[model samples]
Target chain A: MSQNNLTSVVVGNRASISKPRLGLARKRAIIRFLFILPTLIFLAAMFVFPIIYNMIMSLENYTTISIATGNAPFVGLQNYIQLFQMPLMSQATWNTLEFVIGSILFQVIIGMAMALFFKRDFPFSTFLRTLILLPWLLPLIVTGTIFKWIFDQSHGVLNYILMQLHIIHAPIGWLISPNMALISVIITNIWVGIPFDMVLFHSGLQQIPDELYEASSLDGANRWQQFIHVTIPLLRPVLAIVLMLALIYTLKVFDIIQVMTGGGPANTSQILSTWSYTLSFQDMSFGQGAAVGNIMIVISLFFSYFYLRFTKES
Target chain B: MPRQGLRRSHLTIIGALIVCVMLFPVYWTVTSSLETNTQIFATHPYLITPQFDWQTYRIALQTQLPHLVSSLIIATGTTVLCVLVATPAAYAISHLQFKKVTWLIVALLISQMIPSVSLDNALFIIFNKIGLLNNYFGLMLTDCTFSIPFNILILRAFMQSIPKDILEAAYVDGAGDLRTFIQIILPVSKSVLITAGLFAFLFAWGDFLFSVTMITQNSFQPITVSIYGYISQYSQSWNQMMASAVLASIPAAVLLILSQRYITAGMTSGSVKG
Candidate 1:
């Protein structure tokens, strides 16, 4: 009887101790949940919701009319199909590819040159380096506007300078000519993007130890040889990152193009982003616009995947 | 030694020349803003204004001041909202033990890849449904979508560098998580908070895409949209357009000059650490 009583007492103690501990754990979990709840909720409403809604809109015929009527008829794959049929689609796609390629190519080359140049510590080097970032610091609209005037064919400073130097007899249309418009915007983009690339490369260059350079010099390697073998190899990781980021940023470029050309001169300068905007906002073809946006997202995702993989490996 | 000194001086000259070339466009905008309409249209490009004219600036301010004010409010609101939301979440993600933390991080990374244009398309429909269209609150909220993820990532990176012992000491002193965060974490993170806030400010300030898409009303338009509209409307009036562009660029230029270190740190931290 005493043994049974002791056993009952131990069981009662165990249950009583376990109950509050479980409750405390639940309380802690609730508190933890509260901490992240606001961010998760905000992201859900903003990021996740919009993306899902975009996908849904891409599937349906969700035009301004459908929006007004509150009746979006489901038409699976039709919008995507119609996207391919649009004449501007191929041009915009090709232009986007060209823009990304051209912008990245020149930005990296010029930026690398600047980085290598600035690596030598001359007087006012820091001040000059900071000053070089002015183009990047200005808003894209401002850059676009300035470039617009700078390339103004007849009275543009570019023409004035070229004419003064007797480089050309006739004024060259920088933004007006169809063939030159894409190149003009690419030049503007390159200017805006160079500082960003330069800054990253500068940081990367700073990371490479001075000892390595000294060692290369001791082995009778000239500056060019050292740069090719030592600097290039050491800078590869930073280069990969800079190139990927530049690609991603350049891919979604819209402000400059919109301000400069609005992807005009017969849609010759149209990229997927501006074309998407034209389709949805201007033409009110939300479904096709969303389809184009999805296509962009897919492309960005592909790059992002490589970025993630690259970063993981490095 | 003298020859080496001369060579270094030569490098300085070259650097100065490069800087001048880079900054010519910026200088042109300012100078053009101060020039007369006739001078702007002259065949011979005047490096300096023929005559100084403040009329363009006065006109730009007269018409576009309201838009600048709107931009200030929207940018300020976005920064405040982003910091408030991001700080606690960053604290939790970095310090707290949670199973879904990795998923939240992955979500944050993936969110950056989601294009703003795509978000704008869907947000228009949703905001329209709920009467958020043409509203400052709605615009600020949408801007937060971009900054929040970025701010959280930045703040979390900073927060992780804080020693665990300091936070643990607070816990041992009978402080709760909220108090510990406010008293210990926030004070220690002043610099990073400022960095993150500065970036958020710049992001919203320079935003043309969201401002154009979200608010169509002229009165409610941000400076970016206003300047864009001004340029389109006054295509022939180069001076007036340049004046507005100059006006719009001041905030970014000032921030770049003042807090360049923070900006550089914030930018590199995101990519390098990732």
Candidate 2:
């Protein structure tokens, strides 16, 4: 349904407004405007104001000390230049790409597999599908806490299981060893992301007719061929939506990382979100934090353009 | 037919197994919370809680009760405010012709793209000046930034499908706009309202970014921030730490069970509208 398309026609609703009297319609319109006024003011105050304020803050040399002094003088681009100069900036950029891409890759693949498997309507399939959503529904802090212990260097459940399975001789430092820190967080994200992708994918899959599968098989298409040809092509719209939404979700993923590692061990696992937080809160450097935050906004806006476009087209 | 039936049963077994593995961590959270310190810190932590213990949970509850109450207040306040503000707007935009609808929609989408960290940064500055630091009202306002837009959209979607004749009949009955909304639209739209309210409550309840950014004082933190502290302070007491995490997740679990369909429907309609 194009109902999801916000810019779609409002023919039915618009009709009600068509034939009201000039004076009464004016009155009605004013009332309706009044209805939306609360939301308008709220958005302007909470959202638009903060965005502009963040931009202004990014240009200044604001810090905690400035809080007491009341002296956050504007230093144009100084914060951005400082951001670029930091060695952590480049590492975080690379880490964000790896984390987002890695998490999306596995989440989609594994999620797609689960969605396909669950398409075979069996007993308790619906309940099972819903049950799998616990990970997605749980508080991020809980997930992070659980995974931290599971990924502990010594005496961790994951390591114990690996050794028991003879998969490895020694316990792997999943959250330690800066090299694997990002990967560990990515793994935790994938686990959390799978159910979301699966639910959406399954919804998309349900829209495809069983007749198409039957027809494809009758035309000598094998199961693998049907999936590659019929299923994949039909799922393009969903694929685009899922990928974009996942991108947004991954970009906003500050809680789990903050809870799990706090971008620790010399900031090895710091992505832009966590790094912005560290600069703003922990180090009390508001300018650098807002600068990092603005960079992420730029990135989000770029992808959001394409995302809204795809949503419009579909 | 017999072979197909056999395989279907086998698939059931496999599905159950997949669930077991997928949910092991959640299972571990509960079991670990119940286990003693010795049981948890072992080379191989027990997969099951053999000896039940409520002491850790008691200790966690003692420490985290205020935070829980704070989370409840914020979440409930967000739900109340989001519905109160967003409903009238959603009803107006969906039922009436507003030229500003498109702009509002864009703002909603763009607001979603603006990272919470930036809002946290800016809000921190504003809150510092306004003395809203560690304030429930400020935190509720910030949390509703996400909730209000989604509530408006989801509620509007449902309101749009509500057959105009139902509203037109109310208009014919000499009922005013406010009266019509209160009498007819509100009654018929109960499910959507509940769904939206639940989503709002959960979003605020589980919120960490805003809670952590806005509220610095440990005593006034939400259960989320409290549990984050619980992790560090009780690092040795894994039971209490994990128990606190479990305590924090109660709202999510309860709501998920109580309103699974509404939860999923809200989720999809908020994004990929059906």
lDDT of each: 0.86, 0.86
Candidate 2 local lDDT, residue A285: 92
Most accurate candidate by TM-score? 2
Candidate 2 has which clashing residue pairs, if any? none
TM-score of chain A for each candidate?
0.90, 0.93
Angstrom error of the Cα, residue A214, model 1: value is 1.1
User: In model 1, which residue pairs have backbone atoms overlapping below 3 Å?
Assistant: none
**TM-score (all chains, Cα) for each model:** 0.94, 0.95
Task: Output the TM-score of candidate 2.
Answer: 0.95
Per-residue lDDT for B139-188 in model 1, tens only? 98988877888889899888888877687667656566788888999999
Question: How good is the docking of model 2, by CAPRI class?
Answer: medium
lDDT of 2: 0.86
Candidate 2: segments with Cα more than 4 A from true spot: A1-22, B1-6
lDDT at B172, model 1: 57
DockQ of each: 0.52, 0.58
Model 1 misplaced regions, further than 4 Å? A1-25, B1-6
